[model samples]
Target: MRGAAMSLSAAASGFVVFLLSVSVVQGQDDWGVTYTSTEICALKGSTVDISCTYRYPSRINDHITQVKEKFWFTRVSNNDYVDIRSDPEYSGRVQYIFGNNDCTLRITDLRESDSAEYKLRFITNQHNGKYTGSPGVTLSVTGMVTDLQVQVSRLLVYKSYNRAELKCHSSCRLPDHLHYVWYKNRQKMWRGTSSYSVSVYPADSYSCAVEGYEKFPSPPVYAPRVPSVSVSPSGEIVEGSSVTLTCSSDANPAANYTWYKENEVSPKASGQIFTITDFRPEHSGNYYCEAQNRRGRHNSTLHLIVVAGKFLHSATHILYQKS
Candidate 1:
């Protein structure tokens, strides 16, 4: 009976030892930090968030404790890590979000100089219980090109013909190596340089953006093309008939229309449509409509001829009398 009791006691002792060994192995396996992503990209003047989760043994050397200190560092020297939040460059820009075992670092108003590798470190109340994540998160910051502007210039070629010159501009100056791209009505038209010149008509719409960053393009600026003019009562113009002249142009911010007669320096009418209550020979002359906006202006011309009804009847009567 004594031998059986000894065997039972030894078996119970070995079982306890085995359970302790399993618990140690599980604790070691769960006592490390992990990051969701090791690399991230952010736009300059924007914000970024780095996330991670960490763990530690609940009991170290038979003593229970809790986390005492947690911070993020960009560099370590001589077993000492420097906290990024304490740096002057990151002051007021760095924020920490801490949960049970998860942590997040948010940086706002990011600059190009802020790009670097960041590591998370934590210390527990237990003696000599500190850990730093093996690998850190690397951030790359890039600038966004904005405030694009378009400038237009007109040069007289010959007689009444004029040539247009267009140049794309941006408030933020980028590297000279970066090129400019031009878009016509949302379609890629030119790529290479900032300036593009062409004889423009009223149907052309233009926008511009940087070469690498095409998603954010400048608001379209229009080069007013020659306006299309239409006169009411399409056939022969008769005396004492109301006539309407309509002008239309394809332009950004819409085009302002002005009507003028040939050799007249002032506009005879305004708006997209011009009305004449009674048509007469005095109104018969070369007429033109101008389409204009802040970017540019263009004009189109048309001629009108009016005939009196009495003149046609008098000619017919004279022919009958001669016969």
Candidate 2:
């Protein structure tokens, strides 16, 4: 149901060179099955449908060769096949669409493991009458995160803003005219092309998705947000007491925290949490933490004032800004 409208595109865009596979007809046109498409390429988390039609003689040997049962399968051993609907891996996600002489297999919430050769089989009421479609359809479920990516090319970088071009790239070759949907901060933007260009800020994140399969968007590419710092002991700092300073920032690919004191040429620490075992006047300077990633960096400064033994103020003051 996720891609009810995209079923045709999903089924058609298997590959540039299409191959037709069908169940070979028996002698004298007694029985046969014809598949709609031999291959399908669909998004990892979307739904797909594989359809086929079959034919068989109405009467044989003075007895009717009526169809008894029909199902789809992906595996076989010693001439035994298990229906995909009964498989635990496909529980509640597999369905069969049926019409006169036509049957379609619908699988929702598809996974990478679902990529396999799928075949349609039917059993007739006649003795030893069983037919399985030959050369089953091959399904390829591609993951959006790895298969699709946003390529960033910076055009200009200034102190206030940045201008860049973002391109939606796919490892698998897709159709040239496939529509693309751009997203900023997880919201849809007014652009629908393979490439997008816009002005971006340090806090903005961007992603893209194929039209109709918006649920499986590519991983967001973003710079670090403004960092924030907090003191573990939220009380009056006493002399010789341990105090921990923690910094955090929201970012894609995660941000690394580095602690530094004001006017220091080198970093004081290399983690999110920095602890001062003995709180004293020397540690009362302006301390700050820098959160950095591949995209950009930000910092938060904390002013710590330590009196001789007790407090001038109970709470610490934190200042956050872009760096």
Candidate 3:
């Protein structure tokens, strides 16, 4: 009776081993299959996907069994899968993409550090005490832009403080990822985490800037735009005689000035100076200047009054009488 009991115990142990072996070969469900992903993805800052497809080799393509649970493990993306269960780093953020061969791995806010290859596979306990899985898919995420682009705008431009109009302009723009700031001579003028417009003295230089994502290549520094200016000769001229009028102005890129004759409707866009060599009644009138820049043109008026003939004109007249 004792010998018979020993035989029965050995038989039971052999049976258990056989079952375990079967689980290992049949892949838990004894479907006799192994699966893995042949797909590959690029890099971070961009996006990539890992997909898996499998079917039983023992059965026809149409007879393949569907593995309900599929998941992936990533080294860099930190993406997790819920259907196959994943680590905490990727939990909640991952989900099984229904009706699709690929799972939805929404990597929020892509960063540079998210770079690495990932593993993919399926899980099953169809054959008790055994679990089956497919090989992992290798992927690489690449960073596209080394720096973030910034948009810039100017709120005010002027010449002499308060005397003329101050102008601001929108120069360049990119993705709305950056905050705008203004500067002059390397000094931060306005911190517009809120707005872009600013008013300041004309003597100071200016520039606009935008920052976003804390990335490099913020914005290229641009020279400030300056208002155009014009002026007549600084010295005094003889009365009843004509004086040559001159106009000038300063601007970022140089500006153009056109001279308008007083009472007359045409412009003398010629020499810097308009010389009326012969002083006469017609030589005097309301004098003004028109200044132009990339933006457009503007006018500044000068009320010039010519005095009576001076000693020089008198001497000339006397010489003419003698002749």
For model 1 the TM-score comes to 0.40
Write down the TM-score for model 3: 0.29
lDDT (tens digit, per residue) of candidate 2 on 55-124? 7778889998889999999997687899998899999888898788788888877788999999889999
lDDT, candidate 3, residue 81?
Answer: 41
Name the lDDT value of residue 19 in candidate 3.
6
For model 1, name the residue pairs that clash.
201-225, 202-225, 202-226
**Residue 44 error for model 1, in Å?**
9.5
TM-score per candidate: 0.40, 0.54, 0.29
Instruction: Give one clash count per candidate, in the order shown.
Output: 3, 0, 21
Please give, for residues 222-286, the per-residue lDDT of candidate 3 as tens digits.
Answer: 22232222333344555544556565555443456666665778885554456555556555555
- Best candidate, lDDT: 2
| Candidate 1 ranges with C-alpha deviation above 4 Å | 1-45, 48-206, 310-323
Runs with alpha carbons beyond 4 Å of true place in candidate 2: 1-74, 80-114, 117-139, 142-156, 165-177, 185-197, 218-221, 310-320
